[model samples]
Target chain A: MTAKLSPRTEIRLAGEGGQGMILAGIILAEAAAIYDGKNAVQTQSYGPEARGGASKAEVVIASGEIDHPEVLNADVVVALSQEAFKKFASSVKPGGLLIVDEEKVDSTSAPQAIRIPVTKMAFETTGTVALGVLVGLTGVVSREAIEKAVTARAPRGTEEMNHKALDAGFTAAEKARK
Target chain B: MAVKLMQGNEAIALGAVAAGCRFYAGYPITPSTEVAEVLSRELPKVGGKFIQMEDEIASMAAIIGASVGGLKSMTATSGPGFSLMQENIGYAAMTEIPCVVVDVQRLGPSTGQPTAASQGDVMQARWGTHGDHPIIALSPISVRQSFDLTIKAFDLSEKFRTPVILLTDEIIGHMREPVELPDFKTIRSEEYRVTAPGQEYIPFRNESGDVPPLANFGVGYRYHITGLYHDQVGFPTQRLDEIDPWLERVNTKLDKHLDEIALVEEDYQDGAKVALLSYGCSARTARHALKLARAQGKKVDMLTLFTIWPFPERQVEALGERVDRIIVPEMNLGQLAYEVERMAGRKKVRRVVRANGEMVTPQMVLEAMEG
Candidate 1:
């Protein structure tokens, strides 16, 4: 199903520092801007801790120039940790999509969330499976664009596994829709 | 060139190489360390030198020395490191050395926050050197502009024979966007040329123009360089006759070239009564607010200042006369707002400021417009 997105779509990917949410945000933005010909701006913020502290990456995808780069009110927000969910679930716009990690974030605050075991999927496949899940569920960018972006950005020797993870994510999303 | 996603700091590093900058000396700091990291990898591939100095003070000294030795040089740092660089920045100003200093500003009177963004250094970029000397500072609001302005900083420094500051904040420094860079072969950098012969070369000559051609140290020309007031021959002099001419030339050089130096973008609507004036990241917010205001049928003009130094007094004064009120939004309390008030009158300017490491939001600007 093709996702109907606004002219300007603001997405927030948030998790603990070492969860690679920042890299996932970068990959998502690259898929939209570089591979799909849309304009994108990505900005990030995190605590001083090298790992485990709260971290977030915001991506603004637009058909026109992106001003005010940060997410004012997110159209899409993916929270991979309980802390991230608690902190950012309120920031999602009304009727906006909220995706959360099924096992990591146990919260009823956002009942409309599409729950998925993204971290477990990554453990079974590649470290960037969250990116796959997000794109597969939202269709923010085309599948081919994300494939090319993952190939270009994923680490050497991890491309094959990452592609498999993306396929798995598409399947999971399909199952969730049913 | 095809469009590629690039961060502001990485664009700056590559832009320096494009600008013919061959020497880089800097200590790594958050939000700006990417510049040094990228330069370390890229500078050597182009037959340039990159050195990680012991501290910011030494980094400043190293770039100055490299520039004096006839290479376009640069250094990038955050708040604390930028603070350490002030004394040498002044020295470079006094000596008329051409170099670029990139301050990817983080919050600070001291080290406030390493990753958070702030525009608190606006005044520091202008007067941090502790003298009446003229300074040139440019701020970029986007990734592409960061690359473009870095090259402009080098060109202006070499043409005017003074240190130029790329005064960016952590927001723009770390933000990533798609940019299609120009062809490297087409990029050109301004070079210093000595017109006078070996015996007639004067390092501090002000006879023809405010700026004189500076001779490289290893070149055939020999001259003294000092931080103290110097005469035409570059020797220190306490004589008022010798010092007065030097002061006039150094301080008035940028003023004389204000037309060329002051870079601003003006977006005016027919008969718009209110205006938004901002720079750097805050300009992005103001632009967003302008759109929101206009969508609600409010008439507003927007002016984005790329050149933050020399104050752009003429433009602000004219804007003040045309607009009923000017809303100034920045990350600091009232740094540029003070200048706006000075030009536009206190009653005509409204300040929207935030210094708690968060951006001045578009909502804040919208509220300011209402007020």
Candidate 2:
């Protein structure tokens, strides 16, 4: 009997409408497709309202063409708000990583979560929600790919601050692993 | 040249620029508004022109006017706005103006859902303008195909000297993917230019071929244009000799060039008993279902239609001969399926449809396959 080596990676990012989660998904997808030379698709959902409503973006990166673009059971889920954390906590696959913003999300019920002070770190460095979770998912992606993508896709004049946010996220993930 | 992650709407706008389309006039409508927004930002950089008109009606008129001025022009809209632009679109057809209209469809008999995705505009695109005039429509199934087919839409519009419609639903219009676009210099189609000067020019004359070279209005050419059936010199004519041949030429130009304008993708397994025919958003579901069916040891062929109008009857006829059953899944209820039943026999056709602004699932298609 033969065994499969690597399966497709599905990542879902959930937050409020103004947190730039859609842009974050695009950055991650660009990293996988343009930098790593894989196939990636990014789909997003948001309420009619432009901001303050629930928003979510899903990214699927595969070594081959993706048949279904939507994420069925996400391999990694990042929740940036209490509502999103409650909604998507159970949709992660078994043994999958569930990342929550410790300062903003109430993780009282999820002991298995890898909680990080993402909002605080991002605010201190970039003065915005800088997609620290995307940086944390570099364990699945790569540091170089995320770095290049962040540098390339970020808005003009914010490159230096976004790089600092990326460094902070990488450091936080390493410390959590310990 | 460069690989970039782009939304499908953004890619279409860039593809238009790459195809040497230099003028865009559109009114903003949901799911399709981004096409206008991107062009507003990108057009001026390429020395092209972009104008947000008072409404979709004027937007359609402006593009037609720009095309008559010898610049390739285009517009984008959704259902309600598309409904508004039909009159001018018919005018463009009657005058044989070469332009492109992109309808990034959303759910609607009337404003059903602003942001939701649906393939409900297939029939509207084919029969929207209230005439039996010739038109071409293409539906793209993915973000990358959206870019490629938008270029093809311009190419066909210029080559045939007729208005071409790109009928895309919100799903493919909004999804983001990484694409390596072709160089603009390499992919651009040749622009139309007048061969003769003043008094020697005939605006609608086809001395050698079916299509006549269009001359810009101010470029030392004196001619008249109207929505009425006109003679080759562009004047309204009541005589059958002038009117009948004009109608014949305008209506049959696309039919004569079906080989070049009808774009399709076919994946057939030898001796497969069933084939799935789909386009736009539903093509995504059809492909996934085909993969699932193959995994379960079923033989199913797939055909993805890029060109939806002029019907691609040649390819449909060929597929009908090889397969016993044909399955069609669209967002609307049996719109394209009705045509499939006609070509492939009603007894051999199966339809799976939904119009509630939600995608048809792969499991739904698989169950229909098993049934």
Scored by TM-score, the top model is 1
Q: RMSD (Cα, Å) of candidate 2? A: 3.3
lDDT of 1 by residue, B246-304 (tens): 88888888877899999999999989999999999999999999999999999999999
> With candidate 2 superimposed using the best TM-score fit, by how many Å does residue B324's alpha carbon deviate from the native?
2.3
The TM-score of predicted model 2 comes to 0.91
Global Cα lDDT for candidate 1:
0.90
Which stretches in model 2 have alpha-carbon errors above 4 Å? Answer: A1-6, A102-114, A120-131, A134-138, A175-178, B191-195, B198-201, B205-209, B238-241
* Model 2 agreement with the true structure over B55-164: per-residue lDDT tens digits: 99999999999998878899999999999999998998888888999999888989788888888888888888887888899999888888889999998888788889
DockQ of 1: 0.88
> Which CAPRI quality tier does the interface of model 2 achieve?
medium
Q: Give candidate 1 misplaced runs (Cα > 4 Å).
A: A1-4, A124-127, B195-199
i-RMS, each model, one decimal: 0.6, 1.2
TM-score of chain B of 2: 0.97
TM-score of each: 0.97, 0.91
* Candidate models: Cα lDDT each: 0.90, 0.84
